[model samples]
Target: MKKMNKAEIQLLHNSIQAEAIEAMQKISEADSVWRCAYEKAPDELPPQEETEKLALLHHDFMTALTLLAVLEKTMPRNSTRESLLILSYEMFKLTCPNTFERFGCEDILKSVATLLDSIPTPEMLTAGSIDKSVHMIAKAAQYLPKIPIVPKEETPTAATVTVAKDKGKEVNINVGLHAAFAPIVPRLTVFDLSVMQAAASIYASGSKTFSTNQLYRVLTGADAHTRITSKATLEAVRKSLDTLQATIITIDAEQQAALGKYRRYDWNETTFKGYLLPMTKIETAYYSGNQLTAKCDCWRIIDTPPLLAYSKTIKQVATIPQKVKRLPRGVSATVNNICIRDTLLYYIQLNRDKGAKLNYSTLFEAAGVDTSDRISRHRMRKAVKALLQHWQEIGFIADQTDVIESSKNDTIYIS
Candidate 1:
């Protein structure tokens, strides 16, 4: 095919988008007709012949949308990621959707996936396609999860990946080439997730409220070597508590009223989630330990005059899941070099003691890997293989000597 100029590309884009909307309308009409015909029937499934037609229509719709994603990625944009994140927010405002729905991040995944090419090889997927997106994306991602999210650890992360092409195939070239952090401020972590779980689990133990030290013991099993001693780690625990508390995720009317009764801290907005929104304003709190020296013990020693301390002591924001095992006492300032999707898989399957087989499709979608087309799916599979290999190498998962099958919709044994 000959190279098409920008105008030609734009025309093609408009054409495909029209086709996609037309297909979507046809599907809707067909479904309405089928449902009306079967309104009295108990089951909603269409007849086999109708099913086949619906499938074809769905395919056409998706193909057009996916093509649009690929084409839009090539269009020139004036904004630079090097510019201020706030300024990028301005550009995003000019182009992004005017209004956002409360639930479902589907639009974002498609847009970002469009922003990143759905290539034939894994090479591009792992590379820094997400780099420029971070400045804009982080600004927007913080607002996406205002509602309850399953396995909150699955929150989007921006981790740079670089895969080497191997003799007509892609291989585990570079999984962690940059520090990984989700766009949310206060910097939630796998460890913080466990602490939340700990707080939730302890409610069953008849504790109305829990202390950071209590969570610390549960996380590290009270091992003297791993005891929580450093302020860095202590702050991590504190931040997680404060963040979860401020978000008010539990959704009780009583707690809703008490939101600003006590001073609150505003979380900085930045994220790997698919959308963009400016961060909420900070509600300042007065606390003495804000700048404690490395060896300060003011937190441990309650003041004689009785201080109204700005502490991270959480008061039951959520319930529990399995807490992370063998957590480190102090957190390293160095950013974790891991894939965002890998982080999700690891955190959710962290305690799958007995290995389980998960379909590649399920993992692919959850990890936010693109699988819109055959080429994208092919690249996604290779990326998953590389990810699994990294897991085994890092001892996060047991060795998977059994390789992922080249066939589409392969299942992998995750341990």
Candidate 2:
């Protein structure tokens, strides 16, 4: 054994630190790449699947790689990298030998060590040099002595499904694959009611028979996106009902309208129909001809967290626009627009209180306005159209004139 001088030790430390720096940079880059691949690329992979597990695995691998690199850099160059690499390999061998087979190699280990050894070291007599040296040497010594290789756990063989026809029976009822291969049918999240509703509705509509995959896609759809839970496909489906149950806060027409603006299309009757109706599972619906009819039983979607948490964040945002002078006073102005805007707001408030089933006369009475004046009715109609146009402009209203007309009073219900 040879003892090195202070200068030689310092040179070794600098080299090792360089190696650590390189390893950290590479691991970070790899982490980002894996994330992008997981999130952005849909190539040949299931869209509805959650890639979180793979992401976490990638993260852990990178983290371990980083720690090893740092340990190598801080330790002496002679055997520091080799020892860390050995420890990593041994750990993988114990826990996941098959996974280690994919990426673990002598060259990679050696390179990792070399990279850690290349970082620049501070001049001697700086803060805590002796402590750092002692720590590095101790760490290197600790890992160098033993390299563990974990015994492989026996993986269960794939379960087989058998189908046999009952003797002397004309009919053959379908049997579940899980019934035959119970152990292999990976545990799924509990079934969710909302997902059940969506599935039931889909099934009723006579769309092709539902599969776990199709259901997954539907749950991932815009209407059900927030309701999905769990990483396992089956488990996520099972949890769909619970997620839907929790979604008590119904998404209002305004939010629906906001969601619609992201997609472009002509204002046709079909799309208008979709915008007017609430989701299919609702028990009953009513007719409203002119004014928008919002369902009062609108369900909740997300859990309402404390307002203060959000309010502080909002306050932090710059409010310079609020201080800006009104649109140069004459950019736009009209009595019809103003009156109609006020009227719409009035009607909205009244409808909110009165429920979606309110008739035009009832609404007018609620607003303290006369329902009989022909001229007033004409003005109101014009105002309604203008309000619709404004809602359209701001992407805050879907098809505004989707009126379910009332036969008794010849009034329109804006659904």
Candidate 3:
């Protein structure tokens, strides 16, 4: 790949800025529509007729924000482009305070600004450098709001099981196991999850190594179901892994405790403290034909502390009759879009037995979502609906009678 010229880079930056401006304008318009629809009640859902429009507006805003985040990386340090990017970010916050609050964008914006201020100007960015940063930013953008503030709670000592009704049949949902105890890590996109799953599978099979092509097949679902023949898709998956490795996740104090007994520490506590990537390391090899030949020494779960705790927690609950459903290839492809995939999986894992009743508000609280916010509620509803649809498509829930029952009082029962 060739390096991007200054002109080309500036063009990209301008395009991103234009999109950001448009997103801010649309958000302002949407606020007016929202007020008209809900009489200034930000906590109330818009009428059914206007819901789709509102959702589209939200989507546009997020897409633009994502692009803007990428542009942050492409610009030179202390340049006019950087100043404009900062202005756009501040404008979004000022124009859409509620939106920012709902999505928890304040800390992220502050951190990005700090990072921009510290970066020294680079003479020239290579193609590899630009691609890697773009990939990392794109992946990071999807997960910004998903990180939950850890609550004060004692470490769990035993599994807690609850019973619920599904079609008048009794079902068991375990709440006190390692699955529920695992510390919250950075929210992972579907591709990230798929890569982790692939690594887990490889580790489970008594192997510590896999090729990039092998991972590509697993991610696209071709390895488990269909045959993946397209080189383009494979190349895309390879690129995604490169991006995935660049993404970092921070672990909390509780999470650190969970892993303290397992691994010996070598990195610095202050600078490297609590910060780790999902994959410990990834290396790819290319051929003379510019094709990816192999990937080696990719480590996860066992290698990463937080993942180790999470994996251990899952194992502790292995005795549960109905295990957490695995994502099928078709479902895995779009899992990133469902912002609450982790929460949804937790619900399913705990309530997979017959006649399971899950409280909607409780699940939302567990997922660190504020149900009081109308937009957050709306996103949760859509995420749950998408999760169920995907579960059925992947045959995780085969019976048409197995439905999610929602009450007017905000409770969800799984039957």
> Which candidate leads the pack in TM-score?
3
> Which one wins by TM-score: 2 or 3?
3
Ranking by TM-score: 3, 1, 2
TM-score of each: 0.26, 0.18, 0.33
lDDT of predicted model 3:
0.42
Candidate 2 stretches greater than 4 Å from native:
1-15, 18-22, 25-34, 37-99, 112-415
The C-alpha RMSD of each candidate to the native structure, in angstroms, is 26.1, 27.2, 21.8
| Model 3 agreement with the true structure over 329-382: per-residue lDDT tens digits | 334333332224445554555455654455667666555545697885776666
Q: Regarding lDDT, does 1 or 2 come out ahead?
A: 1
Using TM-score as the measure, name the better of candidate 1 and candidate 3: 3
TM-score of 1: 0.26
- Model 2: which ten-residue window has the lowest total lDDT? 127-136
Report the Cα lDDT for residue 220, model 2. 31
- For model 2, residues 1-415, the per-residue Cα lDDT tens digits are 2333333333333333333344455457665666676577657453322345444345345434544444444444454434555655555456655554555566345434443333212211111011000001111111111212111232222211121223433221111111121122222111222243234333223231223333443433212123223346445553443333322111111211223331242211111111101121212112121343322111111111111111122221111111110111222222222223333433343343343343555544433344477887655555455555544455433454344455576354443
- Model 3 off-target regions past 4 Å? 1-145, 148-194, 228-283, 286-305, 310-332, 335-343, 352-401, 404-413
Judged by whole-model lDDT over C-alpha atoms, candidate 1 comes out at 0.36
